[model samples]
Target: MKMNKNYCFIYSLFFFVVSMFFFLFGISIGFKSMIYILEWELINLNSSSVCFSMLLDFKSMIFMSFVLFISCMIIFYSNLYMNLDYNKNRFIILVVLFVFSMMFLIISPNLMSILLGWDGLGLTSYCLVIYYQNSKSYSAGMLTILMNRVGDVCMLMSIAWMLNFGSWNYLFFYYNENLSLELNMIVFLVLLSAMTKSAQIPFSSWLPAAMAAPTPVSALVHSSTLVTAGVYLLIRFSNLIFMAEMNNYLLMIGCLTMFMAGIGANFEFDLKKIIALSTLSQLGFMMSTIGLGFPDLAFFHLLTHALFKALLFMCAGVFIHNLNNLQDIRGMGCLVNQMPFISICFNFSNLALCGMPFLAGFYSKDLILELSLMMYMNKFIFILFFMSVGLTVMYTFRLIYYTMSMDFNYNSYFILNDEELQFIIPMFFMVLMSIFGGSFLGWMMIDIPELIIMSSWSKYFVLMIMLIGGWIGFELSNLNLLMNSLYLTNKKLVFFIGNMWFMPYLSTYMMNYYFLIVGNKIFKSADSGWLEEMGSQGMKKIFDVMFKKNQNFQDVEFFIYLVSFFMWIMILFFLIIFKM
Candidate 1:
């Protein structure tokens, strides 16, 4: 348990330096004109031989740049975040390994390399999640490992299927050319894997449980590295899914997950859990964009989300670290006057998260909503999208209000130390980015057609809905009785819908008929008198005869061995006679 400060500091510094190098390299590559420049051969290695390949063009460079930028921020944040922890050395090592894995994932040219990097990330993250080794943290880490392993299995099967029918090269290979029933199965399995890893729907419960880890781990895992892997997979395979025509199903699942997680966020009191659920909801939005065949939108949202969510979680860390580790929003209030700097930064990030105009989230989320509206052509999907957006604003502001509005019991003279400042500096930069990064990117010369088109009607309609929903949520917060009433109503509806329209009686009926009644009978039959006893007795007798024999048993064993030898000789004699 001895901490190694020197090792932690050195490795952290090394990771931060290397990550900046990659970021600069990616930016240079992204802006270069490959069409005008002469082609230079890049070396690529494989099992058979080393082959020459061309360097990455614009698209690959963009993703790589984003990955590097996020990796750098995460490493820099971890330097201060892990300083006081007992296992600082281990934390620094895992953080560097995580960055390396993500770098490999981004630069991978083939599915095999991507998967190799993907598994590396999963393994390192699992270890980091349980770094505390408390019972709750360990259990949460185990659940994450198990659920993600299921995703890994699905991915492996998909790879096998692809290799069997298609080529090993994931890029440039047209999946539609070899589309078949089997290929469709593989596609479904791959999508399932993406959903599980992304923490969508039924697989989402594990993410909230993962809040048992330190706040920084939650920030990194939820925002940048672990959950986003699914989004990366979908982005990489957008062409294949489009070719297979599975967008409709994907869209449905994404919409459902987004709304459900949004609603769940409304009811959460735990600050970290709320952020975790928000991460799930935002990822669902990204998946929906991918489902709608807009990988660019997904990528844009992913970038904006990482910035704001990381800031928010780090701000939460500041609050927790200041208040002696209190996580419940209800327990602490009116924090803005006390922690003015952290409050301002947290509010700026939350504004971006709430998708307020001119913030990082506005440009990306607006683009997604516009694309979803255009592609699905379903009013219901649009309605759900708006509702989720509304819920996002509601819960986010609720978090703000609960944290900064009620009361400030602590002395107003509390100050942040240098270690805290290390965490805060990155957050301040993120706040600035959340305020301006989207607009800057919007002005950049990228082919985002969705942003180019201006529809007055669509704009008015979306703005009106968002305004109304925001007002409703704001007003509801003032009326205690009405708020409780609405909570009860939503509870009933959610329970009914979640139970497949059958209320409490449905659960009772299923349990009585399927579990209690039928299960009991099956268990009774399985443990019945004659067959059960005979089986148990037979196993015991076999072991006894083999290991616990007396003189009589030894004689019998010798006779059996002599008989086996005689039989072997007789068989050999018969074979020789036949041959003669």
Candidate 2:
């Protein structure tokens, strides 16, 4: 126990110190508007060099710094959160590996080199997801890895296609102003890869299932690093996408993802899953922003979202910890009365998520919304943009109501206290960051002022939607808890929408069920049945019969042959004499 505590503290301090240095360096790099590429020649091929390269600039440095910082906090929180677990040291080690892999992904500019970090994240996260070694965790881990592997394969294809350019240094190609059909294909593949990683549209089911991992792992994977890796990759390739005229597709995908996740979260009752869905919604928001030709705004929102989301997950962990590991929101009520400080932090984070004024989310989210309105979008995209926004607030308020407003619903004997300094301290620090991280990042990331032209109606649209959504959420929360057991109202509808439009089922079961059945039938009829007899069994039986006949013939041969030989000799002598 003491050893685990010491490991956590040491790793946390090491990451904190390193993060500060990287953050400071990133700031300086941003001020100068400079990029430094470090390259090492691994081998020289015909007319090309396979080099390991790292790109150090404002974007990579700043993102890595935040990743390390969040990792530090999560590890510190884990020391107490995972105290009862036997393999705490192994957990810490896996987390450290995950962080470094993210850093490697952040720094690499070469496509070939990027794969090392890319696969590292997928592999490390799979291990972390299955750390508990239970059936549920194993299922989640398999889904997570298999979904990510789709992205991995797409990236490998992209790398192979990039070979036409005679180099794996993607940054060089990106800046060379080359807009060929090949580049478009490459960008399209990259989009698919990013979509899978970021849990967009068809690939969205894995994000919620990933909540089966421990909360700290969720905080790390969902908030900043693993999921956002896709967003970051697209941000780098935004120029190519725009040149290839693919932003429209990206925009549609993003809008649908945002709306789907927002609706799903409202239907969700599990504490961690709701947060996970919110992360998905925010990711959709970022992707849409990128699609709208404001990559910097997307990046700004990504950083800000990471802060608040990580803090939110940490707070949820504390609640679950004190509540004896119950994660269902219906089991919790009036938790604000017992753990007031954590409740405040949790609520504030949710509000920040809802884009409350002056909080971290508001700084970036408001601008994105306003910019979205200013753009020449169709009526449906416009409606989806705001409806998704409203749903965001609606679900948030619903969550707050279920956990904070109602009377206590769970076991009365449970103790809900926030005295664990390790947990509280990390959440406290994240609270401060989630409050201010947005404005600081906005100022630092956005070098030029964005022009805005909107009427009065446009200005008030966001506020109106939020208010209406909050009201709806309040009304929904007032439902008869006694009559409706969380999921009993229109069971089929709730079940369909609540399960992410049945995506998990579609992705996991429906996609494979028929194929597996056919495969089973084929195995029975061919490999184990008719094919077995016709191929090997029939040949063996024929050989066995032939061998038996030969054995019988050999068995009679000795005595019968002697008698026949003598009779044939005497008959042959008489016949020969007659013939002669």
lDDT (Cα, tens digit) per residue for candidate 2, span 48-151: 88999999999999998999899999999999999999999999999999988888888998888888888998999999988888999999899999999999
Question: Candidates' lDDT values, in order?
Answer: 0.72, 0.90
lDDT tens per residue, model 1, 1-580 = 2335456445545655655664555456556744212222344334322222223545455555555555556556766666677667677678768767776666555655667777887898888888888988887787777778888898788767765544444553463465567657777887898888898776776677778877877777776677888888778778878877898778777888888877777677788888887898898888878877788778878878888888889889888887777788877787776778888888988888988888999988877776555553578877776788787887787787778776655555665333466676677777887799787666552443444454788766666666765666556655658867866878877564433234124334553698779867876776664456568876777877877667678899899999999999999999999999
Off by over 4 Å in 1: 1-13, 32-60, 409-419, 445-455, 485-580
lDDT of 1 at 165: 48
Model 2: lDDT to the true structure: 0.90
Q: Candidate 1: global Cα-lDDT?
A: 0.72
